[model samples]
Target: MRVLVVEDDQFHASYLQDTLAEALPEVTEIFHASDGAEGEEEARQGGIEAVVMDLQMDRRNGIEAARTIWAERPQSRILFWSNYADEAYLRGIARIVPEDSAYGYVLKTASRDRLRLALRAVLVEGQIMVDREIHRLQKQGAAPRNRLDDSEFGVLLDLALGLPDKLIAERRGMSLRTVQNRLLSLYDKLGVTVDPEDEAVSLNKRVRALNRALVTRTINVETLEAAQRDLDAWLGGRG
Candidate 1:
């Protein structure tokens, strides 16, 4: 099998290549790309049976690169190795992946044996494997059929951006009351409660809710970044 290891860190990339070569004797060829752009270019060259992708990269993020690669070759298997199990990263992966394609999500901190296991699972056995920690967080942070639907998640993003309810409503084409109701639902889902009598608790409920969602891995940096990009585009169009 031919494998491509796409990682910015030279040491980690080398380690993965060496480990895979040693563990999988059938792996005839292994390629390396230091960044996501290079990875995309190499992927375009073809003959890549499986990819060990890093989630974050300097020039182009892994998600962006993976989206392009999968768009062209939906059959290519991929194993995501990253330090973060951020909901943003997971959501990004969940959104673009082709149906019926095998994939794995394993942390960089995973043991070498575990990494090898994930590689074999996705690359050889065509199985989906997610790190236990990340899988647990995914379940806890989601309600049945998605604890926070897209609309609620949108409201959470607006609140996380520190937008007023009116602005959020205007941006979402929702009434102020509807937006406020969504915010209340978000607070409930995120398990954030505010006490009107507690004068000593100085933090605003919205801020607290956002922070709690972040701390609990219900929301993450990439999610905020994506939301900010959308807002910027919206503002630019309005201008």
Candidate 2:
């Protein structure tokens, strides 16, 4: 397999190159690029098995580079390594790159074992493994990410499917209180809480707020569409 490494820090980039060389010695070709711009050029070249990229860089940010890479080579698996995982950044990646069997994201501080597993999964299984810590932070809504519990997820699914929350509750054996609590939590997380007296009302508000955020670029269409597409593709296959 051929791999491309894109990082500004020479030492750090070299370390990754060396690690891959030692462990996956059979990885025939390894390419090195200094910054995202060079990395973008390198990535757009011939058939590359995978790319391990740094999220932030001096020349061109990894995200932009990744975007360009995605547009150029949709099938080339990508793994991002960053000290910090930006929510907006994550969202952007989540959109264009299909999950499971091709993409992954990890912290720069990730352990060697974790990195290896991530690369292996993308190369072997073509699945995306989001860093668990990144998942947790996004779940808490500390980042500009949407958080949803099982009940709230159900409500959101209904909304996405064009059903009212009240009707959803009736169809799903969920109590009105339970549904209301879910919406209240959603409203609080979304930072658009009003009276919070009605769960259906709250869901309505949450949907509008989410829509506005998504349309305004505060949330991002690519990310959500990618997520929705994945679910549809996966569930469609299952059904």
Candidate 3:
């Protein structure tokens, strides 16, 4: 099977290529891309059966690249290899993945055998493999009562970036009232709702929610960085 390894680090890319060659004889031909944009271009060329995608890249992230690949080729199998199992990354992946698609998420620190197993399972056997840590975070983020939908997550990102309601509405192309509603939902999920007894302390729900998200590991440096990039792009487009 032909595989594409998409990673920004040349050493890691080469290492992955070599590892796959040594570990999996089924991976006959391996292609390499430096970043997500190049990876998407390579995938678009149409011979790659599976992709070993990196989460963070220069121009586009693995999540964005995977979304485009799955959109064009719904049957494509992708193995997300990254150092982080951040909830933001998990949520992003969960949001765009085609229903019932075969995918895998393996951390960079995983053993060589583990990586080999993940690749073979997802690429050849058509299975899903998520790291244990990632699965834990996924479950925590997917709790029934507090799970934040895509809209709520987007609003939470905006709030974390200190975007006012009006600005968020403009950026996201939603009505002001809709943005507020999403904020309310976000606050509820974060358990930042105001209590009559604690009215003074709970007055600023936005700040409380942001704090809660940080404590819960829902949003972190990577999450904020990604959000900032999107916000910058939006601002640039508006100009």
TM-score of each: 0.76, 0.59, 0.72
Instruction: Give the alpha carbon lDDT tens digit for every residue of 102-135 in model 1.
Output: 8889999889998888888898899988889787
lDDT for each residue of candidate 3 in 25-63, tens digit (9 for 90 to 100): 888799998888898899999588999999888777788
**Regions more than 4 Å wrong, model 2:** 98-101, 140-239
lDDT of 1 at 201: 75
Runs with alpha carbons beyond 4 Å of true place in candidate 1:
136-151, 158-179, 198-205, 227-239
Comparison by lDDT, 2 against 3, better one: 3
Clash pairs, model 2 backbone: 100-126, 100-127, 101-126, 101-127, 102-126
Q: Rank the candidate models, highest TM-score first.
A: 1, 3, 2
lDDT, candidate 2, 1-239, per-residue tens: 88999998988888889778866755788898888889888877747768888877766767667777877777778888877655655655754564333778888788888877776776546787788977675555555455544456445544554556676676557987877777666666556655657656544575675664444333443334434544566557757
- Flag regions of model 3 displaced more than 4 Å: 136-203, 211-216, 220-239
lDDT of each: 0.84, 0.68, 0.85
